[model samples]
Target chain A: MTEDVPVKVNGLNHWFGKGEARKQALFDVNLKVAGGSLTVLVGPSGSGKTTLLTLAGCLRDVQHGSIRLLGQELNGAHSDLQRALRRRLGFIFQAHNLHGSLTALQNVLMGLQVHGRSDPVLQAKAARHILTLLGLGDRMDYLPDNLSGGQKQRVAVARALVGNPDIVFADEPTAALDRESGATVVQMLKRLGQVRGTTTVMVTHDNRILELADRIVTLEDGRIVNDTAP
Target chain B: MSLLLQALFGRLPIGWLQLTHNRTRFAAALAGVAFANVLVFVQLGIMNSMATATLKPYGFFQADIMISASDANSMTEGSNVARQWMYQAMADPDVVAGTGLFVATVTWQRTDKALGLTTYGIDPTQPIFLSPEMATRAATLQLPNSGILDRFTRGLPRDETAAIRPQSPLSFEANNITLTLYDTFAGGGGFGGDGFMMVSDQTFLQQFPARSSGAPDHILLQVAAGADPDVVAARLRDLVSDKSLRIRSYAQAAAEDLSYQQTKRPTGIIFGFGVVIGVLVGIVIVYQVLSTDVADHLSEYATFKAIGYGQGFFLSVVFEQALVLGMLGFVPGLAVASLLLWAMASATTLPLAMTAGMAVTVFIGTVVACSLSGAIATRRLVAADPADLF
Candidate 1:
């Protein structure tokens, strides 16, 4: 384990279901992601791209092997340890799951609350700053129901970044955005890596943004087929 | 205060936000809580009033101890006892004073309507009962066939003064004997009937016609100035040779009466039933509201978990919603129940009032009910796996 490696995996395997219906999703996966680097996991659907990402991101329990995230081993970790590790990480779901009841700024502020930030003024300023940078400055008060799909996705990005997480794990973050918004999001993630030493691990199918990734790892049939450096 | 506000209303006002996000759903949930409060409060109020009414007649007399015929289960069923027993009990030096009480039922007949009345025999000069309203007019009862009626009787007109003393010295027939109403007092009637008329023993015997003059129904005894009633009552039992009489302190008697009302009467059973139903209804409504809210926000909750929030955070938010519903729902329910209780008291002449104890009881009950509902509804949220959101 080196200080430059933010995420490291060895012989990780995961299975879904039980008894005779059990089927393996990822098999003996091994990888290492560098710190302050934009790493993208690219593969067709059901090819273990998501399983590996979720396992390394602490969203799923590591079933068969070791996952060391930010120097903490995640195999059979304590619940409190897992939760503490999760606090230093951020996630953006494919569906862009923003709370419908909250305004755009409120949704972003939720990210700060999970970290136990109680200052309303400071939270609002950080949330507003992120939303403004994401090109949602005018829509800060709008609810998810009232915002466009692109604007809603941008809000999710702002929420993921507002807490100043050490690592960001995104699943299809740019799927709902236009070309311009997509470029802007990728640029923001890249800039965060350069300026704040933040690491990003994303699962994507976008071809145009693949060029921006610091490293691209491709998988097939739950096996890593190619690991390329840009 | 500043810190408290920050704790409740800071960066994420999640509880208030979730509840008020949908106006229609929030209003419906509030209505459900208020409805439950009204049911519990009204039924409990009526039940309490009924129990109080059973012991009310006894409450008016200032006696340290009371003696009733062993066969007399309640004041409503007072039977004639040997007056010599009262004289025997008074032989103890702890006994300060004793008075014979006469209780009998009579048919009261006016112009076109007839009603039942409980006639009481009291020697007004002995100060056996407390009635300040009719105190100044006590002399009127010394006149033959004259008695003071209870103003709390149900059959009387709303404007009782107009019908009670209308010119010709208001006379009514009791058991076919003419009795004149000399004054009205503000004591409530017992469970046996809607009216009471207090007269002297001579007047009671005349009204009953068949009753003997020497046999009184009950005996009320006052203890010596510094003596304990329970001890004196116990001593009286040993002094009196009659093993068939029931002797107890006034407090003991009231407790016995209340216990009987609770165990043997339908009012108590019905009120208990109403309380069960109210709690059940509250649980269902709150569970439905919280369940649906959780279902709607399932993915969002998972997002919270994925972003590093623990189960405690989510539980706190849901419980906060429950607390809000409980408090907001209680306000309207208490107000409505208060108005309804007043109307019921006026209409039924029962001693119903919104007591402070009742308010606190119902408020605590509402919060507990809502909290239980919240706990039940959060099963799915707590069991949610953040991996499912993928």
Candidate 2:
């Protein structure tokens, strides 16, 4: 509940298939993520880093053990509770899954719209404000089809942060960006953690991002092999 | 458009935005829906016109009540009742006049186009016609081998129908006997024939040598002024000792005949199946479009789920798109159908019209039909898991 730990996991396990084709993804994993801190999950392909991130972010059903996210148990929870818990969270995929038909501004507005925001004038204002901060002020009216890869990723970033979620879970948020933009994005997350007490958990293999992480947790073959505080 | 959408749904019209995103697909889907609408409208139009045509001959006669054999089914193709029923019906105080009309279908040769003309043979002596204009025209048929033709008949020579007056008569050979038509009437085509022909009882005998005047196809009775036709009809039923006669008010008999044509005929069944085919075509076309769109945007929908948008939200988007496509397509479909119906009505001289009842029925039917397709298309998106997107 305090700044020491906002995300606590105990002996969490998850599987991918069933019966003869059953396969395990995570096994007896345990960790605590401090509030207002950037925790990075780094691993090679099929190393279970993405699996652990999605499990902790409420993106998948927690199969076994307990995961207390923002003081709420997620294992075997009702769908209503899961959806309510998800509303207070944010997610950024590596592909930047922005709606192709929506403009940059509308895409950001969707972040707030899921929470059933009623005020149109203020919602548009807030959406515009966040897009402007992401250096997409001139591209607010441009559709995703009209934007480049890096620009579309920024729109996705603006969409995730516009709602001011309690915690952000990103899977390679900067993969589609150049060095300067990726550096700017990581700095923005770091600055938000210090100024607004917003927690961020990202899974990435970017070397430049490793230098700025407050803590690094690496997974290999479905188990934590190394944990370090930089 | 936005205001209408806001009234029905919320301010953010996500469905409309997504449907309008791909211009080519939207246009194609709209056209498909419109084509289906046209198919349905045309079928319903023809079916409705048949209902109206079946009752056309009833308006030509001037009877307050009619008597036919109890086993009779419709105006045409029914057993002929004994002519003694006319005298028995006239015994009532409300019975002012009566007539024995002989009706039968016969083929007439026009030197170019053969016509199936329903012959209504009367004495031309009783008050048997509703309009004085028709009565005046029928009076000319009293002469031997003389008759009047229906100008409103389909496929009739336009100038010939107009020129064949008393001064300019036209002769036609039919049933191996030549008859000359010296006048015309306003009666149109119906289920019995392509047109109507007025003849004397003697001429009707010549047309059908075996049909005796002792029995007529129907008995028409004219009740006294300010008297209830229903009351006189009921009295006739009791006074007539014949159990084979079916006495009914003029309006009631025509209504029963129309219903009989709509429900118990081969043409009715064909039109009903035609309507079913049209609806099925519409559902299949809309399903293809909506299912394809859902497949293309699977990842985006999964992202919405990751963002906590529920299954209900996705349903609304697809349903909204369906409603928009159906309504837009119906507008053009209605316009095109009305024009075609107008042209058909003019050529056939039937009471084919675009009514408000018909429009409202099609509008509601299309909406419900398209929504069913939309519901089916969303089943795949419901199964898409957010975990798979990572």
Candidate 3:
């Protein structure tokens, strides 16, 4: 795992449809994310930063580019391989899309359950431990509707980390939080990537938190324009 | 497989939690299902009750064979057999006993009041296989023009010396007959209403002067023990080459009656339509319900899909929800049907019995309907590209 590149994208181009209505969402994007590194992508709205992250995460279908995660080429791979990529990748969204019907702990355990794990007690314990580490130890039984904004985001972070994914993708994860809560979330993500050796790619418009990134890449339009780290 | 099962059953708590979270929506959906069930079950119950009412007349009979006019296809209208057919039938070694039966519609009177009724004329000496209650009542019944009156037709006595004044318009004399409401048979023969009378042959002839020629309409036969009715019936047909009369074993008659009900009556057609409607309604409702629920949780589903949850897994969850609703709705539907049948049975002579086979059939039908809807509704999840979530 130490020698493996967590994510690599080269000349990735994606279009929505055919004919005149076709619109390019990502264009000639090239980037590499090293293992155990915190990479932040900063861009304006619709700058394709999220598209780049999704492409690297194997969440979107790539049309005209190559992507390799953990030494496995995603382009032209079988459905099973693609599924394996998703299983090993963790994703966090800004909205904290936790299920309203499930409690905070159950939402975290849902990650493991989705990956076909059947041990309820083990899943529960792992989810509880992750939530506890994220400062949500007392809110395990709280449903999404019952949780505050900051608590919900923490629960979402717990869910992303519960499976111990090789790579974690966070898109504007702190956009809905206040300044204090947002800083705390950024610190937690930095520690997760730097201390635990989990490669993390975050897309955000908040440049104030750029200092927490091990490497920061700037994107304009759909291509990377600058990089602060070699 | 175990994981799938766990997810399938594990979702029950989630489903309940969601339902409780929104009580109004849950109640609305449940009510929709319950209403659909009630419509289907009530329609089916009516059809079943109609069939039972149609067959009730034969239920009380104990004849092994029924010999009617050769062209007679039903009990309502058939050519008459000669009274001597009874003697001829009894003469056969295989025949242990035989009776003449006269069936006709006649107008009866109790002191100037008159009403039409179906008359069953039987030999007083021979046993009437159709209704023993009617047989017992026949003994005490007097001949026509001077006899007892049925509870429905019996009126107060009238003056006997009364005569019409001179130059009055001609008035027809109404036949006075006795009627005893000893037996009440259900009145469903693919027709509208029911009224029947059972009387002795002498009394019937006296009342219905047009039928006085002693020509029996049908002859019922009782086969001797260890006798084959089919063989005896074939032999009888040979003996009576007159194509005017037909002889049929009881089993054949029962089969023909069942076939007639299935093919000729509207019960089968209506019930079949009802079942089709039920399936279609169930599919639409279940599909809409599960599909809406999925759509409501689209983001959550996308999250699961991003975490390697296969299309099959999500499909299973949808199927489980449909099945749960189907089972829940089915229990109440069947219970309502049973209650309706019981109430109908008490009010009318219809026999509405629910068998294990019917229950199984309904259960399978509900499951299949729900599963089909579930499968169709979840196609969106299968084709969903997780990349869109970003």
Model 2: per-residue Cα lDDT over A104-128, one tens digit each? 9988988988988488789899999
- Candidate 1: C-alpha RMSD to true structure equals 2.5
lDDT of each: 0.84, 0.85, 0.70
Candidate 2 Cα outliers beyond 4 Å, as residue runs: A1-6, B2-8, B62-65, B86-98, B128-138, B141-146, B164-169, B176-182, B200-203, B221-248, B342-353
**Candidate 1 lDDT tens digits, A99-184:** 99889998998889888856678888999999999888999999999999999999999998898888999999999999999999
Residue-by-residue lDDT tens digits, candidate 2, B223-267: 988999888888888999996688998888888887777777888
Candidate 1: lDDT of B139? 73
Q: Tell me how far the alpha carbon of residue A69 in candidate 1 is from the true structure, in angstroms, after superposition.
A: 1.6
lDDT tens digits, residue span B1-390, model 1? 224424774436677688888989999999999999998899888777877787777755678888888877666565777888888988999887888888877777656677677778877777545445545656777778888777777687757634565233568776667888867766664557887777877888888777776677878888888999999999888888988788999888878878777667676677778878987888899889988998888888988998888888887778888988999999999999999999988888888889998999999999999999889888979656788877
Q: Ten consecutive residues with minimal summed lDDT in candidate 1 chain B? A: B1-10
TM-score of chain A of each: 0.97, 0.97, 0.92
Q: After superposition, how far is residue A149 of candidate 3 from its true place, in Å?
A: 2.6
Candidate 3 chain A least-lDDT 10 residues: A1-10
- Predicted model with the maximum TM-score: 1
In the order shown, the candidates' Cα RMSDs to the true structure are: 2.5, 2.9, 6.8
Better of 1 and 3 by DockQ: 1
Return the top candidate by lDDT.
Answer: 2
Tell me the tens digit of each residue's lDDT in model 3 across B58-121: 5545577878876565554578888677677777888888777777766644455664555566
